[model samples]
Target: MQLVALVPAHDEQDRIVATLAGLYRQTRRPDRVVVLADNCTDATAEIAERCGAEVFVPVANRDKKAGALNQALEPLLTELADDALVLVQDADTVLAPDFVRTAAVALDDPEVGAVGGVFYGEQGGGPLGLLQRMEYQRYAHEIHRRGNEAVVLTGTGTLFRASVLREVRAARRAGLLGGGTGCYSLASLTEDDEITKAVKTLGHRTVSPDGCRLVTEVMTSVPALWHQRMRWQRGALENLRDYGRTPVTAYYFRQQFLLGLGTLALACFVLFAVLNLSVNGWQGAAPFWTAITLIFVVERAVTVRGAGPRAVLLAALLVPELLYDMFRQAVYVKSLIDLALRRQEHWYAT
Candidate 1:
């Protein structure tokens, strides 16, 4: 039951030490900690080395995070036993002290192939950050509601069995999966989502236990949040396209369709509201809709209560969060349009 941690970093000098330190603080520390420093121009590698982590810098890896991970995992998977666990965590996230211990317990079940962390946003982005924090708290609520079944193996932090990863690689090579020969799909923009599909397709369950938690970086501004979500939404659509209507992708397809409907519903609501205001003057709200809105507000407030007083306050504000939801709905629509038009996606820093 050997445990190894691989942190994929690209110019993360500022956050590298803290991330590594979090790993060291784990209740169940990794037997080996390797930092995959991909094309780093900063002091990321040196800093990681100073913190006593083995740094594996990929040679001319242009495929982004997926490529860097494949390069490092190749040797490690080959060297480690089938039962050995490998944790692929983002360099910017800080895991809870019990993250490793809890995730390991979950993976102890042979049927569970991977364990993902329940993540919340780190502080300091002002209003936007608080919104993201509230959103993450809701996500955490959903995970709990679903009994820890992983909808997606988030890249923020996920633990995997070396055997399952090798199986994923073999599945790709044998044409059972679409990610080329590597464990991660080089062509997919959202490698995490694609890998979740791959794992489920292999008949393995993914879980996100409550004790396995982390605090991840959030978008600081509207532009950053927009770009980040665009990539996420678009990448998800593309992965669904690549996988096509299988049992593995059925839920994802439904999710996308619902997202589109949600967007359309919001747009229609705004349009009809303006039309009514111009034509009929300020008519009072209907009781049914008011009740519905109340229910929604209550749900929002309750879901974000774990995020503390400030988050609860924001969730209670209603309009601000509604505006945020409208913005996300727009991203969903834009992502669909971009995918339909076959527009190129440009990755940018948030």
Candidate 2:
């Protein structure tokens, strides 16, 4: 079966070379590699061309990745057959030598429409970088353990059948995907989630393979992580509106419910502290909350074995983790508001 690797890049000169080098290392090389350089002020296109990829520079637009991907696919579809597999990869991710081969074999099954590989964090930057690495490693471990039970959330290292993509494109043309009236809109951010749901709606399965793997860089700073999470939360909220009332909508609702519970728990704890300060003393309820917080820390520590003892201990300290949770909740609330306002999502390099 013929395969194409599509890499969406924008101002990624620093990371593009390594990504291409990894692609070159793939055991089963794709028939073609297409790089969508979207509004890049840098030499991303030139660099991609130097790396031997067919580069396409798209017109600047609000839809960002989705727009660039749609434009890139137009020419690819004309050149390739409808049954070809298209592997969508981010510019920051590096695949294993056998990643493409594994994905191709997995998708050979008629029932599997899409497949994603395991994502791990690369190390050797600094303390903040190490923290981010540990966080991602923990997340990857959970996702890996969950296997195919976990929802296919992102497109960082994912492969899709061209037939499935055509169905998604047809739905987009009919205004059945995304939130806005147009076929493609800047208001929708999590296009991967939307497409995965669409594939499932068409009775195709999406899975994460056990052998396929990819390494990705994570945000090194807290502020960067916050912004990235904010965009994801906002995009997820926007995608929820499109799914509407379907049984598959439970995934979105489950995330919202968990966030709501977290928010309510924090609020109740604050109220209890305030009441205690007014009635009894400063020491009141502190120990109880501390114990409760320790429980969460312990759970996280047990859940993330790759974090090492030191990182797990740090997580147990609860000073920064609690603050992180608070920040996440705030981001979630703001993203919901942004979605409600129908504001355009500005894609930023994470």
- lDDT (CA) per prediction: 0.92, 0.76
Clashes of 2: 0
- Runs in model 2 deviating more than 4 A are 60-62, 124-131, 178-187, 274-296, 340-345
C-alpha lDDT of residue 190 in model 2: 72
Pairs in steric clash, model 2: none
lDDT by residue for model 2 over 191-307, one digit each (tens)? 776766777776788887766788888777877877788777876776777677577778668878898798879978879978978987776456887798778878877765675
For model 1 the TM-score comes to 0.98
Candidate 1 residues lying further than 4 Å off, grouped into runs, are 285-288
Q: Quote the lDDT for 238 in model 1.
A: 93
Clashing pairs in 1: none
Which candidate number has the best TM-score? 1
Would you estimate the TM-scores of all the predictions?
0.98, 0.86
